[model samples]
Every structure is written in structure tokens, then in C-alpha cells.
Target chain A: MTATLNIGFARASLETKLFFRQRDAVIFTFSFPIILLVLFGSIFEGDLEGTGITVAQLYSAGLIGAGVMGVAFQNLAIGIAIDRDDGTLKRLAGTPMPRAAYFVGKLVSSLVLAVIEVALLLAVAVLLFDLELPTDPGRWATLVWVLTLGLAGAALLGIAVSSLPRNAKSAAAVVSMPYVLLQFISGVYIPFTELPSWLNDVAAIFPLKWMCQGLRSVFLGDAGAALELTGSYELPKVALVLGLWLVGGLVLCLATFRWTNRGEG
Target chain B: MTTAIHVRGLTKRYGEVHAVGGLDLDIRTGEVFAILGPNGAGKSTTVEILEGYRKRDAGEVSVLGVDPGQATSAWRARVGIVLQTANDAAELTVRETVRHFARYYPNSKDPDEVIATVGLSEKAGARIRQLSGGQRRRVDVALGIVGRPELVFLDEPTTGFDPEARRQFWDLIRSLAAEGTTIVLTTHYLDEAEALADRVAVIAKGRIVAEGTPHTLGGRATASARVTWADGYAETDTPTALVRTLAEKYDGEIPGLQIVRPSLEDIYLDLIGDAE
Candidate 1:
């Protein structure tokens, strides 16, 4: 057990170094969410319709959710597929490293990336845009749980989805097309209130919608609650939905993951 | 000598085709054993099965005294494998790649020392993708042996190497053998087997058709030698006697004297041809 932990840490450190070395990917992942926050916050001017929170402040939470999805889902899924295609997974298979260590290393990398992204997004919003962060201890606790559950859910979903691609060469297109579509209904690209009533029902089936709504509660505080359709953060529902996705995605990935790209002996 | 690998009636099928058909073999510890065969000969499949990376349909096989089919991380640690494919973190420096894999084993060689052993010390800081194919193969060997394993499997380790690089690789394998590492290698080059292996097995149609020391494979050591003089050539079991008679006839040294034994490639070709 201790060996796994040590190996996992070593793997994570290696992954982190590799992740940061790709200057384009690093610049893009960290900057994309913050760029969205700045753009929406600047253009919308003020809170819409009935919500007391400003547009930038309101969208900050959703953008944070988007950042998590990008790092934990898209990046991880594509990276895993490429690794499979390139024989990285097969090389690791010959080692004494536990399979769980590879997974733990991946999860750890996603979590670290997610945390850095969220911190940068929040810092920009709070300092430049006057986004109101929650002062209450309970709400802060809610933020921690929602962020943890949301990142884990998305990352595991990415891992499970990775098996669908024929090879790493095509994995990016296979995963990103659906994800880009999901962004439309999930409110990452559009404000949840402005989305059609029918789309809300459709988006509610996935975890990202609840994740974005949960982030709004933490970042925008009291004023953010009114903007939500439920007239509240819907924190309990968010936890349940994200929790189910996290646990369920893990089961699905474990059952289907293949070390070798080739199927037979 | 301890047995590093033992197999009986091992079989695997890919639907209608049999990849490994009832193959059986044994390899002793501290000896370099080479499996030589052509493409699609099921050598990789059999190696993968013994490495605990593939499933077998029928057979009892043991590697390092543990059934590879049920191998665990501890079992894996004791066996090192350099796969036929070139695999490494492309973005990582050779040093970093070696150091990272080293963490997986309970007893491992120092990463820097391993790098030096594989002649990659100068390129240790270079990204793997920047290195030549042969250099990448050296990295694979470094990773394989860094584990300080009881048994090591090199799956076609020098397939892409130039003659000079291949010779250097053979020296490295010799050093590992001197340290008492049991090595099993697979290759298509007959000379590679002759240079590095203590024993060579010619695999064809998913079975070992011939197995013995490289010097004596296919009765090569005892095969009739060919005596050539200025006039003609004749096959004789006692070439020295024939040469003596020829020298006497010529009144000293035999004219244009030369003796030739069947090369390993010739014997290997004959054996594979007979199997087919």
C-alpha cells in the first residue's frame, strides 16, 4: 500500500512536469476559462432579469466548472488514448507498478490542474471583476465538496469514454465533438437562465449542469441563488447527481479498461 | 542450475488460427536463451504469455517459480522485459524515464549507473523523441535491467540497430550475463543469437522445431566439413585427414586450402524449411 502511494506520487510528479512542459496546452488550459470569465463579465454589463449578481460574477462559477471539465475530461481522455496508441500503457504493464498507481497518478494530475485553474479563475474574478466569494464557513465547505465531486465525476467519465476511440490518433475528435455539444446545454457556453426551458430539462440529466450551478452558489453567494431556476443553490441535488456520476463512472472504467491497444494475443 | 522458466503444452488460438500451438520449453537461470523465428511465428505471443501480459488457452507455465497467468506486482518486479516495440515517454529525458521506471522495483540499480551501462550517459538529458531508434532501444534495455530482476526478457532488442550499435549491445548483454542475470531474447538475426545466446531455439509455425547451443543447432557442430583446394571440393567427416592427404599430394600446404562448415543461417533455414 505504501509502495503504491510512493509510486503514485512519483508518477504524479512526472506527469505534472510533462504537463507543464507543453507550453501551448498549459497556456490554453489555464487561460481558456479565465478568458471566458473576462469576456462574459465584461460584455453583459449587469445581472440579467431578476438576479442581483452581475454577469461576470455569475458566469465565473460556470467557467470554473468548464475549466474542471476541460482538464479532467478532455485533456485526460485524449492523453490516455494517445498513451494507449503509443504503447505507453503496455510499457507500464511490464513494470511492478500497480494498475491503481497509474489511475491514482492520473487522478492526482487532474486534481492538481483543476485546483490551479480554479484558483486562477477565482483570483481574476475576485480581484478584477468584484465577484463575491462566500464568507460563511458552511458555504466554503460546500465549495470544496462540489469542486471535488465535480472534478472526479468528469475525470472518471473521460476515462470511461476513452475506450470508445479506435486509437489515440482519433481520440481527440471522438471525445471533443460530444463535449462541445454538451457545453451548449450544460451552460458553460451559455447562461443557464437564457437557455430554453426544454434544454434545462435535457441538461439536468448530466452532471456538469449541477456542477456549474453549484459553483455559482459558492462564487456569487446570496445573489447567485436567485439566478438559479430553483431559487437556490440546489446543493443537495448537486451532491447526489455528481456523487452518482463519480461512483458510476469509476465502475464503468474499471470493467472495460485495456492495457494493450490490441485486443488479442 | 535453477530453472527460470518452464512450460508444458502451452496453447493459444486467435479464432481459426493457432498463434501458439502446444509449445514446450525450459530455460535455466543465469544463461542467455534466444528464441529466433520469422514474423508471425507466434514468438511475441508466447513471450507475452510468459510475461503475464497475455492469456493462454491451455498449458502450465511458470516464470521465476510463479505461474505468470496469476502474476502479481511482486512477481512482475522480479522479471524484466524489453518489449519489441519502442516504448517510452517521448517528452521525457532519458534520465527521467529511467528514474521513473526504477521506482517500480523493490531492488533497482541506480538510474545514472544504468544509463552509463547502456551507453546513454551522454544522451541522458535528451528527450526520448529526439534520440535515434537505436538510442531509444538502449533506453528500453536500461529500463529492463534497472529493475535488477532475476530474469530478463528482451523481445527483438536490436532489431533497428546498426552493426556497430548491435556489437555494443551484445557487449552490454554479456556484462549482464556475467552478473548472473537469466536473459531470454527473441530475434530474427541468426548472427545475433550466435553472438549473445548460450542456447538458441528456432521457432516456426508456433512451435520450437530446433533447440540447442548455437554452435550445435541442427547438428551443425558435427555436420560434415567441406574441404576446398585449387582443383575441387569434397565433403568429409574427417576434414583434417582429408587436408593432410591433400597437403601430401601437393607436397606441402594444400593449394588454395580452405575448410567450411555450414553457417548457423544455413542450418536455421534448413530447419525452418523442414518444419514447414
Candidate 2:
């Protein structure tokens, strides 16, 4: 089992390396979030001071979710779809490598990339936009757990969504549809609290809203005291919800994922 | 010698279409066995089932003495497969790709030695995408043998190769067989089947119509020989006697006279029924 795990890890690392080497993946995964952060930071500069949360804080929360979505959903769904179309998945299925190993590798790579993206976004927020870092270590720990669970949820969602793409050309459009719409509904672009009550209720059912809300509780500190959570960012409940999403997503992915497009061809 | 592959009543289907309809075969150890069939003839489905890639709807298949559907790690380690299309690990150099695959097996051959064995020593350091199609095929062959498997499956191994490259590949395959590796291959080239296979099977629709040595497949050896001369040709049971009579009529050797039996190509086409 240890050897099998190592095989999965190695394969996942190779996949991650391949992803980073692609010019478009690199540009969108790393640079796109940073650009959005900078753009939003400048636009919200004057309005954020009165609310006691700087523009950078808002940008950091929103863009971090965006970064996770980019890697976990858009990156993974399209990547898997293309692999299926190209016969890569079928070839690997013939090998001794277990099917679980392949998914494990994708999960590991997406989580690692999510951590890196979050760290970079926080650093930029702190340095350029004068956003305050979390003061309480316990809160910081809770924030880490939230991010971990949130990323897991997103990755599973991505794998599940990948099955919708019929081929490589249409994969981007299919995978990106839910992601783009989620950005609007889940406060990745607009804050959830400001959205109408009906929209807020709908967005609450999605893991994305919970992820951004969890992050807001971490960074905004006393400003989030009025929020109804009982503890540090409501970590336990958020973790449970995200964990449920992860399981549900995995089930959907396994049921829908095709090893080859032999039917399509 | 032991039997390398033992398959009986193998069956597979795609919806209502039977891809492999009750096929049975046995390949002995250390021999080169070839499967000949046209496109969509269920050859690939049968091979895939034997390789543990596709599950058979109904059959008993034991490769290296273990059922492929319940294949263990040791069983997989003992089998090597060269697929029709090359894997696209374009970013990795040929050496890197070979070396990466080596780690999967328990007792893999040295990567550098495998590269040299496949005649790809010079192209080892080049990225996979940089290599020509034939060179890329060499890389696939290198990866397939890098594990030192006891049985290797080659699916149309030289499909797009030029004449010289095909000959070189044939030599490589022969050398592997000479070294006691059991080879089961499928190819469109009849000459390749005739030259390399110790025994050949012709598949049509979803069943094996004929199986034997290349010369004797479909009674090809005893099939009426064509007696030809400069003027005309005729099929007869006794071609040597016909040629002798022609030589006597000429009072010397008959000009351009030659007796020839049906080639493997002729038998194969006839068995598959002249759809070409």
C-alpha cells in the first residue's frame, strides 16, 4: 500500500508539473487571481476604510476562493476531460496502478496548489493593501482547516463536473459554466451579505458560499462577531458540510467519469 | 515449455454488438504468436481482455496461470503491453519516461539498457515530442520491455513504420523471442505475420476462422499451386508435373516458368471473404 501511495504521489506530481508548464494554466492559475486582487484593491480603496475592513481583506477572501475554483474546478475538470478524450486514462487503466491512485494524485496536487495560491494571495494582501493578519493562533488554525476542507470540496466538485464535457473543445465551456455562475452567486465577485435574501438562501446551499463566509469570519475578526457562528469561524460545522460535499462529489465523479470516449468516437 | 496464455470461451459485447463471440486460444511460452484480422474484427477486444484492461462478458482467461480479471501485481509485472498509439508524455525526455515506468515493476530492467536494446540510445535525451513517429514508436517499445516481462503483447506494433524501420523492428521482436520472451502480437501486415509468427490465427466478425502455421493456414500449403509461364498460367494439384511437361514441350527450361502456392495474404483474404 505504501508503494502504491508513492506511485500515486509521483504520478500526481508529474501531473502538477505538466499543469504548471502549460502556458494557459500557469497564467490563469497563478497570475489571474493576483491580477483580480490588484484590480479590486484599487477600486475599493476609499469605500473599505469606513467598514473597518480594508479593500485588501475583501479582495483576499474573494480571490482566494477564485484561486481554489480555478485550480480545483476549472483546472481539474478540463484536464481530466482532455485526458479521457486523448486515451491517456484508458492507457493508465491497463496498468497496475489502481483507479483510486489516479484520483488520489489529483487530490494531492490540487490541495498543494491551493495552499500555494492562498499563501501568495495573503502575502500580497498584507504587503500591498495593508490588510491585518489574524492575531489569534487558534483562529489561524481554524482558518487552515477551513481552507483545507474548502479546497477538498472544490476538487471533488471539479471531478464531478468534468463528466459533463463531451470532448476537449467543449470541455472548457462546460466546466467553466458552473464556476462562472458560482462566482456571482457565492460572493467571489460580490459579497453574499449584500445580495438579496432569496439569492443568499440559494447560495448558502453551495459549498462556495460557505467557503468564502468561513474565510470572512477568519480575517474580518470583530466585524464578524455579529455573525451567528458559536466558535472560531464555525470550523467544525463548515468542515462537516465540506466533507459531505467531498463525498457527494466523489460519488458523482465515479458514476459519470468515462475512461475513454469510445462511445463518442 | 509452459503455456504462456490459456484462454477459453472468451466473450465480450458492446450493447447488442458482440465484439468477441466465444473465442478460445492458447499460446505456448517463448514462441511468437500472431493474431491477424481486419479493422473492427474483435482482435483488439480479445487482446485487451487478455491484458486485464477490458473485462470479458463470459470467458476463462489465465495469463501466466492467473485470471486477468483478478490480476495480481505479480501477474501484471510478468506482462508487458505495447499499445497501438504512443503515450503522450511529450514534456519528458525519452530517458525520463522509460525511467519513470521502470519504478512500477518489482524487477525492472535497467532503463539505459532497455533504451539501447530498442535501438533508441541516441534519442534517449530528446523530449518525446521532438522524436519522429518511428522514433516515438521505439520509445514505446523501450517502455514495454523495460520491466523485463515474461509475456509481451504487441498491438499493431509496426502499423505506420516504413519498410526499413519495419524490418528493424521485426529484428528486435525476433531477438526478444530468441531470448525466451513469449510474444502475442496483432498486425495488419500479412508479411509481418508470416515472417514473425510461429503460429497465426485469423479472426473475422467475432470468431477465429483459421489457426495454424503461416504456410499451412487455411490449407494454404496444399491449396492448388499456380503454374505460370511466359504465355499463360493455370492452377493444378501437381504444379511440378505441369512445369516438367512445359519444359519438355520447350525441349529445355520453360521461359519465366515458376510454380507458386497461395501466399498468406491470399489465404487471409479468402478466409475473411474478399471484402477488400
Best by lDDT: 1
lDDT of 1 by residue, A1-265 (tens): 8888888988988988889988898998899888888888888886666666777876787788888999999989988988888778888988889888998899999999999998899899899888777889988898899999999999999998888788888998999986777778998878767888999999988788989888877777776676678798888899999999999999989987888775642
Backbone clashes, candidate 2: 0
Q: How accurate is candidate 2 locally (lDDT)?
A: 0.83
The CAPRI class of candidate 2 is acceptable
Most accurate candidate by TM-score: 1
What range of 10 consecutive residues in model 2 chain B has the weakest lDDT sum?
B83-92
Task: Provide the lDDT at A193 for model 1.
Answer: 74
TM-score of chain B of 1: 0.97
Top candidate (DockQ):
1
User: Which segments of candidate 2 are over 4 A away from where they belong?
Assistant: A224-233, A253-257, A262-265, B274-276
Model 2 TM-score (2 dp): 0.93
Worst window of 10 by summed lDDT in candidate 2 chain A: A224-233
